[model samples]
Target: MSRYVLERVQLSAQNHPKRHAAVSCAIGGLLVAATSALSVIQRSETVSWPAVIAVAVIGGGAWAAAMAVFVVRLQRRMKPLPPETDPARVRAARRLMRNGELGPDPETNALAVRMAEQLQSIPRWKKFTTTAFLCTTILGVLVTAPAISDGEVGKSVFYGACTLFPLLMLTVGRARLDRHHRNAAEIRRAAEHRTNTEAER
Candidate 1:
């Protein structure tokens, strides 16, 4: 059941690189717009509207081009699983990979069990990065609030929405990563217990 779900997701992503790339470019455009707005806000006393628009357009275009190329290359490297492959093992392997515990032969159960031991505790670097993203999210909202309250409701909404998009992504991505980590830890403990019971027998 879990294996089927995992494989379906993997196959969908692998088969739809263009869709993913389009989504990435959209997100990139939001980030670029937010950044351009921030620059304008910082120079409010001497802001040039034309320059800001030009910068945002150029930045967004460049980001879209780069992401399209990168996504295409990445997708090209992902090989599809054979019809005869075990989906359960593939699911386990991907779980390990997500937690950075996947070994050379990810499809092997024994290798996955041994590698899972490394995920017993969350790494400090992961915590630090999550904290950094949270801080940035908070800062982005705070910085955009005054502008949002000003007379320019239209412009404010545009800037706020653009800024909020990435912040939301950060928050959501963190939550998903934490969930994956928890699932990985549970799998590790189960594997360890099974190993010990087998050894005792």
Candidate 2:
């Protein structure tokens, strides 16, 4: 059952390749735009439109190239499922990809709980790095706060927003992960209770 679930998860990537690619590209573009804007904000008062355009072009090109490589590698790695495979399960897997939630199937929910548990066991170095990144972003927000008092409202707001973006994303992601874990755990417990009751009969 676990193997079946994993295979379906893999095949989900193949279900809407173009849609996935487009979303990824859009995210990359936004990141590049943010970086370019940050660069401009950190520059001299005499803004050079040509320089800003150059920065945007370079950032966009780099992001595009990296995304292309990623897509190629992902394509090469994904193996297509057999045509005779269950369409309902395939659709469920794709739905899971879209929203990080499993179906009501007890066994699938058990697997998801296990996967979530594994994800929670972060390495020491990774934990350290994550803490460091959060600290750096917080520091950025603090450093820019003084600019607001100095009457540079626009610069301060932009910098603060840029710094806060990562923190906001991390908070939202963590909340979602916790919700999924709790749901999976509940499903697993219910399945166990049912099995125990059946055994007593």
Indicate which candidate wins on TM-score: 2
- Tens-digit lDDT track of model 1 for 1-201: 463975655555556767767877778877877677666655475768787788777877787888788766666655544445565665667666466443445246554553344333324366677676677667667767777777667556765675676676577866876776676666676666766887999
Worst 10 residues of 1 by lDDT: 115-124
lDDT of each: 0.64, 0.60
Error of 1 at 144 (Å): 2.7
Collision pairs in model 2: none
Question: On a 0 to 1 TM-score scale, where does candidate 2 land against the true structure?
Answer: 0.52
lDDT of 2 by residue, 52-151 (tens): 7778778876786678566645544444454455545555543443345656775444444444343333222546646866986887777677777788
